[model samples]
Target: MRIAMIMNGFPEISEKFLINQVSGLLEAGIDLDIYAAVRPSGSMRHFAAERYGMYDRTRYTRAARSTKTRVLDAPRLILSNFWSNPVAATRALSTKRYATAARNLKTLYFLEAFGKERYDIVHCHFGPNGLTGSFLKDSGIAKALIVTFHGSDINSYPSRHGTNVFRYLYERADLITANTSFTKGKLVANGCPEGKIAILPVGLRMEEYEFPKERVSRDEATLLTVGRLVEKKGHRYLMDALPSLRTRFSALRWRIIGDGPFMNVLRDHAKELGVSEIVSFEGTKNDQDVAAAYMSSTVFVLPSVTATDGDMEGQGLVIQEAQASRLPVVSTLHNGIPDGLLDGRSGILVPEKDSPALADAIGRLLSDKDLRETYGNAGRDFVAETYDIPLLTKRTVDLYESCITS
Candidate 1:
């Protein structure tokens, strides 16, 4: 089936989960086309993007322009495409349904779909993009619309806008997929019908991560966290747990992978805690480097907490990656993190913002080698059984087919 995959940006380094899904869909022999709102700015990207020719498949729109500029350019945009598809060009100018977006020339990009054959299904990765996909369905650019709610879209966006912000999109979407049960509840809270939403977790490519037969034997207490340096990630809590952890272990170190606006804040926090030397803020790394970090680490810790804007974690995709690598995890009981890993079996869960509990969980795994090995082995098995990409991709395909038939 020919599908249109909608996204905010394409080939983002941090969003390896998206790349994994794209790769899986292509492997399943699906004709997929990517429609991105904007192109990614960085040079760094996943190798799979190149291997799978994702860039060639992607149709990128020009970045957002000023409202005045868009208004002035509206006539040209319409005249330029009217000859090719007059009906779609006319529909793109409708202010009744699209209002601001149409006036701002955003709808003109969706009109470009008429230049090619109509899509069978349009699958949007996040809620905001889903709204765009809903427009596509409404405009008859695609037969079906499927929107996947990851994290902030459900938790934080509605807080800024009202719960009814998604009411229109919800009614138009043929299917809605939530990455976790926690995320699914948030959708229902925002007025999405219970029968329409499906709980589909972000999956991992199991074969890529080599499950360790035994825990890494190391003298230094190496704690690894892989995620963007954001408030919700709670990297500060890891710094908070450092002082207490130092008293118990002589050689303790924490390596944080991925980068964001909060890097300097985390650096300052580490300095204030007098654990700057112990905390290493390694910037963004590609999939291969991330896999290497997971295999070499002693314990994985992700202390996720709700953000100031009510944003929380989704399924903790990285948590599954670490578990897949056979590394025991220690994370907070925030949002859908619990669904990503088995508490006390594959990993440990502490209350959000509890540094002592965070340290205790990390220390427990550090102190007991046998327990670490036990958790490590169980983690690999759990991820393989629950979050395998091939199986999940097949389920996604089934969902797409069902939407078309229904």
Candidate 2:
């Protein structure tokens, strides 16, 4: 079946799971095309973009442009594509959405670009894009529209835009997928029809992470956390836990991967807590570097908490990534996290924002090598059986078929 995958951007470093899904779907012999709302921002493109020849099959339109650029570009953008798809351009200009097009040239830009394609289904990766996908469907660009809500889309977005902001999108969409049960609960609580929601998690390529039998046995315990340095990641709480942890464990080293606005704050917090020497803020790492960090570490921790903006964790993808490496994971009992992590099996889960609980969980794992190994093995087995890429892709295929037939 021919499908159009709609996204905020293509080949984004942090959102490579979408790229992996595209690659997996293609390998499964599905015909696909990508339509991106925004031109990519960073230079660090995933290699799979080239490997899968996605560029040739993808179309992108800038999401927002300055008023000056819009005025200058909109005329040319409309006229240039007029001869190629005159009907679409003319029809787009006459539609009510054209009012939006007239105001925001990027709206017109997306309409003009996406108007060229015809697809059986339009699958939007995040809830915000459901409107664009529904517009495409309403304009007869696609037969059905499916939107997947990850994290902020269900959490922070509602707080900012107000709870019913998704009312139109939800009413227009044909299907909705939530990455975790907690997220699905939130969707229904916000008025989405419960029957339409399904739990389709972000998956991992299990075989790539050749489950380490044990964390490196060493003089110093190496703790690892891989996530953006943001409030939602609970880095501050981790720092809070460390000061007390230092009292019990003399040889402790913490490595943090990924960077964000909270870097300075976290660094300052670490310094203020007198744990700066033990903590290493290793900024964003490539795949190989992350895997190496996973292999070298004793335990993986995702101290996630609900952010101040109401943003919640969407079932920590890093949890499984760590588990795939057979590393024991310690995370908070935050929204969606419990769905991915098996408490006391994959790792331990503590109450949110409780530094003492987090420290105790980590300390328990650190002291017991056998417990770590047992949890690590169980975690890998769970990923292999449940969250493996190939396995999840088949489920996706079934969902696609159901959408097409119904």
Candidate 3:
């Protein structure tokens, strides 16, 4: 089957799960193409994108243009692709339906890249992209449409645009996939049809990770957190716990991987809290760099919290990744995180924004070698059984077949 995937950006360090899905599909010999809105803006890169030759298969829209620029280029864009698919070219200009994007000729530019090709399925990663994929279905370019809602798209985006923002996509999409059950509930609350949605948590390439044979000593343990340095990630709360943690464990260290808009703020906060000497900002690292950090670290702590705008963690993919790497985790009980890890089994869960509780959980793991080893082993087993990429990929294909045949 021919498949086309739509996303907002390509090769993002934060969206490794999407790359894993694409790579798994290609490895299974599926004919797939990617259509992205923009290229990578961050310095960090993923190996799978290069290994799978993703760039060669992706088609990116041109950079954003001013109203004057788009008006000037509209005639050339229309004349260039008018003969190839005149119906699509004309349908793309219906301002009544397409709104501002149509008026600005953004749809025409996308049509120029989409060409006249047809696909069996067009899968979009987030809600807004599903609205874009709705255009493909409306223009008769795709046989079916599937949209997957992660976290922010269901909470933060809708919070800004209002809950009914996805009503148009709900009517047009053939199926909707939620990364977690919590996200599914949000979709239902926002008026998505109950029967149209499915829960499909992101999976990991388990074989890529190697569980450490030896545990780090309790006297000199390193705490690690891997994710975008954003407000919702609660990096500051982790820093808040560090000063108290230092009083207990002198040789303790915290290594924060990944970068974002909040990096400078986090660095400044660390200094202000007098934990700069114990904290190290590792910036944005690639997959290999991240895997190595997982191996060297003693505990993985993702202190996720509901941001001011009501955004929360969906699946906490890195929590599973840390478990897959055999590192014991201490994370918050926020949104879908509880569904991702086994509380008190593979990881420990604490309340959001409670620095004292965060410190206690990390201290418990660091002080006890036997408990750490047990949790680490259990975590590896849990992720391998529940989140293997090959198994999830087959299930994804099954969903596609159902959509195509129905």
Candidate 4:
């Protein structure tokens, strides 16, 4: 299958799931051309991205602050490097309209990218990009469209872009996949055709993780969470849960593994709650760093909750990732988290924003070694059975095959 993946950027820290999908697809005898609406802006690149020579295949749209900058940069970039990067140069030609050059130049970039390629499917990674997919098909790009809604696309995007933002995408796209049933529900609520949407869990790259032979103990008990420090990640509530947990497990250490806008707010809250020394702000660690943290940590928790502005987690991939590394998880029953876990069998699910419940769950896991081991082993088995990338990717491929035949 020939596929064009429309994405926000390459090598993004948060979008490793997409990278895993791409790598899996390639391994399954599918050919892909990665089309980034913007360039890879992050300093960290996934090991798979580097190994597969993806940088050589990636074509980026001109990302600029102003329309004048975009218009100027597009031609200059294409003209100067047409011989070296013929694909991008041909896609971003001088034939686009003045209005397009001023506003929505990325549309022109997208048009040109798919314009030159004959693809079996134009798969968009999020709902907003699915809007672009619809535009591409309407322009007579001979391919079916498939979109995957992971999280914020349904939670934050719809609310920000208006409820009818994806009306065209729903009507035109051949198929859609949701990361969780919660996200699928949100799409159906917003007028999507229910039959077209499939629930596809974003899975872990099993090779990259180590399934511990048995529960390993750390010298000093540590509780860890990995995600951008955002409102929905419920880091503040984790901070609130800490004071209580600290009293019981005096040597307990907490590590937060990503950075975002709420850094100052979370730092201040940690200090205000008098747990700064015990809590380490290990900002923006890479995948290898995370894999190591998973092996070392005593327990993993992602106390996710819905944000004030209606934003929520669709599927917390980190929950599964933590489980794969054999760490007992303590997370909330927020959104699609419960669906991702076997709950009482694999991990504990507390009510959202319930600091006492979260603290208590952590305490229980810390105090009972056998219980922690049981949950850890069960969690790993659950992920290995249900969330393997190859199995999940095959399901995605079946969706693509259905899109082609239907």
Give TM per candidate.
0.93, 0.91, 0.93, 0.90
Count of backbone collisions in candidate 4: 0
CA lDDT scores, all candidates in order: 0.84, 0.81, 0.86, 0.81
Deviation from truth (RMSD, Å), model 2 = 3.0
In candidate 3, what residue range of length 10 has the lowest lDDT sum? Answer: 211-220
Q: Higher TM-score: candidate 1 or 4? A: 1
Over the stretch 52-82, how does candidate 3's per-residue lDDT look in tens digits?
Answer: 9987888987635356766776678888768
User: What C-alpha lDDT, on a 0 to 100 scale, does residue 233 get in candidate 2?
Assistant: 92
Question: Per-residue alpha-carbon lDDT of model 4 for 1-406, expressed as tens digits?
Answer: 7888888888687778888888888889888888888777667777778887777878776565466877677765555546544544444332222213224555566665555566788898988777777666655564799989988888887677567777767888898999888899989999999999889988987666774456444545799999989999999988898888888998899989999999999989988999899999989887888888998899899999999998888788999999998789999988889888888888999999999999999999899889888998898889989889899889988988888898
Candidate 1 residue-wise lDDT, 216-295, digit = tens: 44445889999999999998887898999999988888999989999999898888889999888899988888888888
| lDDT winner | 3
Better of 3 and 4 by TM-score: 3
Residue 18's lDDT in candidate 1: 90
Residue 326 error, candidate 2, Å: 0.6
Cα lDDT of candidate 1 equals 0.84
**After best superposition, candidate 1 residue 255: deviation in angstroms?**
0.2
Output candidate 1 Cα RMSD. Answer: 2.3
TM-score of 4: 0.90
